[model samples]
Target: MTKNFDRLLEQSLDELSVQYKTLYHDSDIEGMKPLAHVDCTVLKIHGDYRDTRFRNITDELSSYPESVNELLNRVFDEYGLIVSVWSANGIPLYAM
Candidate 1:
């Protein structure tokens, strides 16, 4: 990633309080740096509890934001998803 884009991603991750986006590196003195061990990106499709934002029963069939949609699309197309879904009515669906 470009340096500028890296900073931007870090800023956005911080704004969302995403704990996985960064780590306190022993080699780095400037504080937390982007996680470099793996190319893992965590998507909050179910929303975040820190800000008390979550998807409800009604939201089960609702569309996600464009950005989320794009990521979801790209992830399914590229990295693949291992999902365990809870139905709107609270039924447990097997992971795929």
Candidate 2:
């Protein structure tokens, strides 16, 4: 399962990177960066530019037991963009 998840994460990150790059390019934002932090990996889009930040929690999915899903759901509902889950590779797993 972990291996499958890792592959998924890698794919997701690649997709997200392309998407973000397009967004930034279209917006013509020179210094814009999309920062994402999952449990173990930190992925930064335009990391050198240091403009925007995105916090996601997909990394915690494996650690959190099924019982905590309710609590996690609540957090997602309440925080909106404050918390998210990303895959180990820092691809967004869930966004709120």
Candidate 3:
């Protein structure tokens, strides 16, 4: 990826908490809340828990970085709350 895209991706990940809050507000479930903290792998993958896999996040890290995504998926498999993105039903659509 280009330097610009890298920076954009970094910014996107850094702002995940904010983006999550906004999305969660509109689709907040009874028992679901945004994650208070995230891990290094999660941050690196740039997975926003508040983002829905089924929806389009025009202003966020809508997609995962390839090199990181696969590796992150393994981490997710082990413990799927690193960057846990939930659906309306509270199912984790993707956790990296």
Candidate 4:
């Protein structure tokens, strides 16, 4: 069964927001927001280190550990979602 964009967006935003808040060290930070496309989503961490420590952590493709893919796939399998995290400047980080 295919899920709609609203449902997918709500699910992703709810689950990942808290995790990112802690990871980025900013209470307002939320990761993985829905893009304009129907099925696309992007990680929403800012590039400013003063606001978040995730810059170095998410700078390279290797920064996202294999476990992230495994977890995201496992958790979001119902929606057939493949996460693609992008930098603030629009660099693709990792996809899985």
Candidate 5:
């Protein structure tokens, strides 16, 4: 179900006026370094829908993976402003 959701979200992202990058894996973390101020990046804070490592448990959300931790630190320290939104079944990652 979430796989299909990811696809739909991907489509919506495509329709957006800005460019976006999905940050869910090491490759994604590495790939984000080159993003200019114009780029829109999606930090899938919980995890990727397709990966088994995707965090959906209480313990998992309590501590992020190393890559995710680094990425989050970089994101929080580098970017002055951040925005996030999710609908329908969305339960925010931070609430856990």
Candidate 6:
């Protein structure tokens, strides 16, 4: 991946890590492993979480500000991977 793509992926991973930690305080290794695989650009949630899976995140980013979306989309469109997102639950969310 290009430097810009790497930076964007890192940023997205960081953001998800924080959010995952906050959402699942009692999360275990299994629960956390999926977080490492999430494709922030494509918003793909992959893992064995019962309640979590690769959820279509194309629109989810809309919740963020325009600037954030632009940056995220730029990276996602360029190098987003179609992978699984980590979830405290077992089911992985999928893109719609």
Every candidate's lDDT: 0.46, 0.36, 0.39, 0.39, 0.59, 0.37
lDDT of 5: 0.59
What residue runs in model 4 are displaced by over 4 Å at the alpha carbon? Answer: 1-51, 56-59, 82-96
lDDT of 2 at 59: 63
lDDT of 3 by residue, 33-78 (tens): 4234333322323323344332235654465446445544644576
Predicted model with the maximum lDDT: 5
Candidate 6 Cα lDDT to native: 0.37
**By summed lDDT, which 10 consecutive residues of candidate 2 come out lowest?**
20-29
Q: How close is every model to the real structure, measured as TM-score?
A: 0.44, 0.20, 0.25, 0.25, 0.59, 0.25
- Against the correct fold, how does model 3 do in TM-score? 0.25
Look at candidate 5 and tell me the lDDT of residue 10: 57
Which candidate has the top score in TM-score? 5
Give the winner by TM-score: 5 or 6.
5
Candidate 5: which pairs clash?
Answer: none
Per-prediction tally of clashes = 0, 6, 0, 0, 0, 25
- Scored against the true structure, residue 83 in model 4 reaches a CA lDDT of 60
- Candidate 2 Cα deviation (angstroms), residue 90: 23
> Weakest 10 consecutive residues, lDDT, candidate 5?
1-10
Decide which is better by lDDT, 2 or 3.
3
Model 4: colliding residue pairs: none
Which lDDT value does model 3 have at 85? 55
The model with the greater TM-score, 3 or 4, is: 4
**Tens digits of per-residue lDDT for model 1, 1-96:** 111112444566578776543221212213423334435454445543343344545755276566556545765776776665556697987657
Each prediction's RMSD over C-alphas, in Å, is 12.8, 13.9, 14.3, 11.8, 5.5, 13.9
Model 6 residue 53 lDDT?
31
Clash pairs for candidate 3: none
**Cα lDDT of model 5 by residue, 1-96, tens digit:** 121215455567688755766666555666455546546676666657676657676886687668776766766678744444555688554421
